[model samples]
Target: MRIYQFLHNAFLFAASRMQAAGLEGRKEEQRLWIQVNAYRDFIMATGQVYLFEDYLAGVAPTSRPHVSTALGARPDTTSQRVMALLLKAFDETPEPEQKQSVSLLIHQVNFIADTGQLEACEDYIHNRLDYAPLAIAHFTTREEAEAWLMGPAEPPSPADILIGDEYYTAVYSREDNVRFMSRDYVIEPYIEELAAEGIPPTAPAFETRAEAEECLKSHPASPFDFVSIAGEHYLAVHHKRLNRHTLHPVASTLTQWEEQKRVVEREEARYAAMNTEGEDEES
Candidate 1:
């Protein structure tokens, strides 16, 4: 049922986009689009009836991803065959919980009465009867219509849930406090040269980028560099290899000893960590 609806929607959207792009044969496309909308509007009302009259009364059906995708786009098809098929599916639901879930989903989705119902439309009834006229009730006000569609709004949409603190979080820091996510935090990297110079890495954390760079002026071999957080006074030194901030005292004040001890220590730490990982993997 959803597949058919999805195909219907896909056709509608493709036609709309192409028409917007000023493609040829727009007149025929427009006519088809209108026909499709009429079918869709008629079916939607019928679907609502089925949900209330039949679908919600039975055990719920499962695994309708295709149908969901089609419903997501909200297409309408007037073909008698598709409408009958969908109405038939309402009977397939068997579980109470499934019915409840679907009921909630229908409310959450807020599928309003399609305005296309202004057009007089009918469904073919084959040998048993003649084409039947659709008489769908529509809402007058936008708010009224939406309220009806959304129902009681029990579970609440994500937008409704993400109130003050949950939404509009601050990013970057300044001299004053700002709202920000954890990702907004920038950590400076520790300098090995500073470690060898008896200055502990991660200490004397630079509150400003200029201070870190001034400290780096002499030792060009150092991998740690400063990056300023947007709109934040604090500048952080980032270590390229470690992919992290030093989070230690700023060691930018140290001079280059032209010695290999600190570099050797860093290499040893890397090798040690790698070996430990390898051993863990083997185990």
Candidate 2:
């Protein structure tokens, strides 16, 4: 987790949240204060500090799309002060036990922007920042952010490893039948065909069937090869232009698409209930 990146994204999320929270009618200073403090408190509360950057013009985040600013865009006042003083405040101002328990998160954001080291960014993160007993986490998703706070520190695992091996790019042939959906078709045998046309590997395959269908935006084209080692088959996805990592909708038929939607919704509900139950048990 490149903390600077995470922090920037977190600022945007906080600003958008503040805007969504409807702080606009308040005085400008008051709104900024709330926004800044809301984000600051959020960072500190995580302790583990598991953590988007996108900014519209000077306009409030009321309607801006969440995306990172161009490289080197000067951060607004709230972001600047919040990040600049983040470690200082925690490292010095917080109580003694708090300081030791809540370790500092290191960042490569400055180095990347200053040097334009895109390749080096990954290397630096994996080599230096990641998994440091002292390093704080920077989460991207709401689930992970919440987990960082509610769950114990993440145990080191394989996902933390970055092999940089571009072994496969996702490509899939869709099955006409709506129910027979699949994605992340590995065509390494056809690597010559892809290489002759000069296309890099597609985005990595989705680990879930729901995500694969979403990318296809229709019924998965497939003969339905369900590869489940432990009765766990996943739907994968591949689109030339759109991100393969994201989930898309199934489009083969209305009924099938609705089925997929229902499946995803049910899974979400189940997880929500589980989280609530866990919280209740703890309480």
Candidate 3:
């Protein structure tokens, strides 16, 4: 988008320069005019209209060398040099419409870049061709252009996760504060219960009652407890809330548990509504 804007403005500046030169009867030196004409022909013939869009879409330019040529050959002089180039280019082909288009472009470029040379170009074009240059506000520098040509400071990546001292300390304290499980619970009986409930067993069992107890406490419903017991390994579970019981199942194989809960809730609601209706009729 910015490239298009810049190009559009540059063309306008070129037009203005041509208009000024015409008015003043200032003929460009023959050799310079020839060069400008050739350059303009090359641009008009090969310029990609959607170069910026292609770049953004990750599409490589068909002619890489052309890209370098376009940007690298950018004229350093004021808008006059730009317009002279366009006029010389237009004269070679002698396309009336193309000349007019280039003239208009020069006017636009002059307005955007706010270069003084545009006034001279505009005067030349109007005096010679009886065409008035369109009045345009001066172009201000676009911030995007600056940033693109000169990159900004790097920003940190979103996925970076930084663990602070407080977080480390909390985790460390939790692990350190845990007591050995062997001293608190029986491992063999727990494993037997788990096996009766159809839990699969594991190997490389806990070596001592304390080790088994710690494993059980860490992962209370794990199938490893059964393996530990069958292997004659001691086991333990956390004693802090060992006796506390909850009515809900420890684990469920059903994937639609939430849906099932909702269905049950709906059924209960329907029954309550029917009961309420019957009581009302009785009253």
Candidate 4:
């Protein structure tokens, strides 16, 4: 994700949460207020906070094609106007099973921009454009901002630690401050148990499946192989460009684990050879 988009999305989420906090009670409202203020202080410190007008002018050219076609014809189209059109289009769209106009609009914005222009727009949003609504609070020093953000500190407990070297899913118990690792995908019960005890889930980390169908965003290319142990298998997912391989278990029976080892070695060799050929060509 681009930094600009990430910030914008985060701000929206925070704003929504803040508005919701009002009805939840004083404590919840105060907590949300502090968090929002801290975030705003952090934004102000970055010195990249943008005003809406400046942001529109800066990214408009690149973003224009991704918006409504009629917007292209107008000389005075503003970001607010574009947003209203998008919202209206989203609202008028049919159900999820049908062709979604909102989905199409999202895809257009997400995938159609030229890479150079996208990067330039992101940089412009970060350094030059205006996002003033996000940064409502100010702090004099980094330490002051950090201290204010952290608020009163509690006594530290034992740091959370992963239980073992290998696992498919891990869950942390705050009561014991221990992370339980498992080879199986049965993590939901543990999570529910924790939530019942008032310990909300931290971010979840799951091992990517080594199978042909199941994959990770990091390693897109599939049909992976794995090292089969006594009965278990660990995947051999390799990235040819990076000359790197990730190991994870997959419950598939196609090739021997020995074949996966050979495949990893082959991928490394191919990448090395390509680099060598490129260097030779340059010379």
lDDT of 4 by residue, 1-283 (tens): 1334544554554454456666666564435333433333333333323322134344544322244343344344232232344455455545552223233333222321321133333333343322211121233444443343345532111111111212122232334444332333222232233334542233223343333224344544232333433445444433332333444434332233345557769999999999999999999
The CA lDDT at 236 in model 4 is 41
Instruction: Give the candidate number with the greatest TM-score.
Output: 2
Compose the digit string of candidate 2's lDDT tens values, residues 140-162: 44344344333443322111111
Q: Candidate 1 on 55-154: residue-level lDDT in tens?
A: 3334354444123333434356433223233333234546554433333333212222122222233321121122211212233344443443345422
Give TM per candidate. Answer: 0.18, 0.23, 0.18, 0.19
Residue pairs in collision within model 4: 50-129, 50-130, 50-131, 50-132, 51-130, 51-131, 225-236, 235-248
After superposition, the stretches of candidate 2 with alpha carbons farther than 4 Å from their true spots are: 1-84, 107-250, 253-257, 264-283
Compose the digit string of candidate 3's lDDT tens values, residues 19-71: 66666776664333333333322222222223322333452323111112222
Report how far residue 91 has shifted in candidate 4, in Å.
15
Distance from true position, residue 2, model 3, in Å?
A: 2.2
lDDT of 1 at 211: 62
Q: What is the C-alpha RMSD of each candidate to the true structure, in Å?
A: 23.3, 18.2, 30.4, 24.5
Q: lDDT per model, in order?
A: 0.34, 0.33, 0.35, 0.36
Q: Which has the higher TM-score value, candidate number 2 or candidate number 3?
A: 2
In candidate 1, stretches whose alpha carbon ends up further than 4 angstroms from where it belongs are: 1-22, 45-283
